[model samples]
Target: MLAAAPTNALPRWKGFNVLDFFNPDPKHRRQHTTQEHFRWMADWGFDFVRVPMAYPYYVRFDRSRPIMPHEVYQIDEQQVQHVVDLVEHANRCGLHVCLNLHRAPGFCINAGFEEPYNLWKDPEAMEAFVFHWAYWSKLFRAKTRDQISFDLLNEPCLREDMNDQFSQRSAVPKERYRSLIVKGCETIRASDPGHLVIADGNNIGNEVIDNILDLDVGQSCRGYAPGLVSHYKAPWVFEHPEHLPEVTWPSVENGQVHDKAWLREQFAPWIALVEQGGGVHCGECGAWKETPHHVALAWMDDMFSVLTEHDIGFSLWEFDGTFGILNSERKDVAYEDWYGQKLDRKMLDLLTKFV
Candidate 1:
């Protein structure tokens, strides 16, 4: 029999989303203050930041030929330089970074993509996807594995049916997704040994963990804590309410039924899978401004409690913006001014359990 793998204590992780880093506009790109952001996060006691990158933003997508600026797939020297500078800056400010591929070369799980790269049916698209990961693995060769990690893909839609919005039932099964994850892991490992890779569940939603646990990926899984609180308010998510009911606060119980208990149910299977597969991390979770200050705080309190209890490492959904700890409209809501009400001190305190 194999001896048990050592259980590593989950790090007390906190940070924001580094969105639009590669957008052409200087205003949007400048918003990603490599040094300033890290300094602020450190000041707030956060140790990590999730940098979401759109592949096309870095690599111009073309249907006729291989995407270019391809020093490594579509990514070029300029993009790599920016990332390296940010990583170095983060180190200077005492922050860890998780590089998330929000949009892959030919595919974006999010509905907004004009042409979603359906890997299940398109052979060329799938190859491009693999090539993209291979390129990233090669580019980040200098950084120490733990100093930076890769979130394979953000919120992989499992729906196969083109008609079914959530249907992942295409020619590719969940097993193929798992295989692709392992393949990506292998590629990364080959390029730079010991680099940590985070594999997100089927969908980056609370309900997908149970479904993921049943699939065999032959490696540790990362728990994706969907922004129910934030997204619950997002116009696109269908059930968002501008003001949550009073009952939604104190207890996880609510008329919706998908409360704390539902969260627990989602986690249990993942936890078991973690034990069996080795370990896991909560890759993403947060609430939006739609949730009133008090309700968001309450929901966060519950979220931290459960995650800490399970010894799960986590990176909050974002540092700033709709689901951000600090609203992106910092000029208007200034971090200094909104820190008291918007920061959720009580919830941050609960997160100390993980620390």
Candidate 2:
């Protein structure tokens, strides 16, 4: 019989996402991650790493003009082994890994990339989704919950259609998204019931906390509170101005004051889920590189203040790029060259202090 799960079976997941793993460039993908990266994270006082990997990398796709679901898409065992090796590496370094599907079979937040069918509405897509998770369960069957956990999907939201326009307030009903989650969780449990599964909140992991409470799974909330501040001037952000003026920490925007109180209120739904014993995590949150250093830190302080108060852990959007503490090229902040990479000392200290 399986031992009872501890009350705190969920770790306070403070860490980073190896962004390089998400639809990486073919030529340099191999150079993106190494055992040293996990060691670096562990040494930096982080105990976890949430890997947002793309599913397309593991499945074979047809080169035909329009990709069809019926076309043979095989899971490459070799790719599976590569992920397994990464998990083992993370374990050796004393950091638990959260394996996530950033780009699943039939849906994704990205444009230009085609997933053909809708993940929530299409039967074929749902089948492929379950197949992916079931295979992962079998692959990591020997792994215990403490060593690794499953983040079934990444930033799932209500999509307008298969073409990638989505929003927090999606036309797709919450019940439909919840049902799809139930199916995915069931598939994972069928293969490996011992492992805990985490379902990303709807709307880029920002909303719909109550919807997944019935499932035997944890919930992940996005930390990009007040998107204007966190994603300032980011090209990908909707309606991003070609040139944005510097934004203040508590400045008023969109007719609402931006402050700590507001930040806390935004987390109300996730807090409610946590109160109901529905283990909640701040899965992804960070400011863009172009944002001024002082402004970003102040905004992050308020965000972390609320997270710390709630005893919730978070994984910063990344580890070594635009949003990461190390190698983050914020022009306004002075950085130290640590091991040939730019390290923002103050930023790193602030993140660690919160933990």
Q: How much lDDT does each candidate structure score?
A: 0.58, 0.77
CA deviation > 4 Å runs, candidate 2: 1-9, 24-31, 62-66, 70-72, 164-171
Over 4 Å off, model 1: 1-12, 22-30, 61-73, 159-172, 205-228, 239-247, 250-262, 328-335, 338-354
Cα lDDT tens digits for candidate 2, 256-313: 9989999989998777666666687888999998777888899898898888776688
Q: Write the per-residue lDDT of candidate 1 for residues 59-103, one digit (tens) a residue.
A: 534635444433225445565677678878987787877777776
The TM-scores of all predictions, comma-separated, are 0.76, 0.91
Return the TM-score for candidate 2, rounded to 2 decimals.
0.91
Q: Pick the candidate with the highest lDDT.
A: 2
lDDT computed for candidate 1: 0.58
Q: Count the backbone clashes (under 3 Å) in each candidate.
A: 13, 0
Ten-residue stretch with the least lDDT total in model 2: 24-33
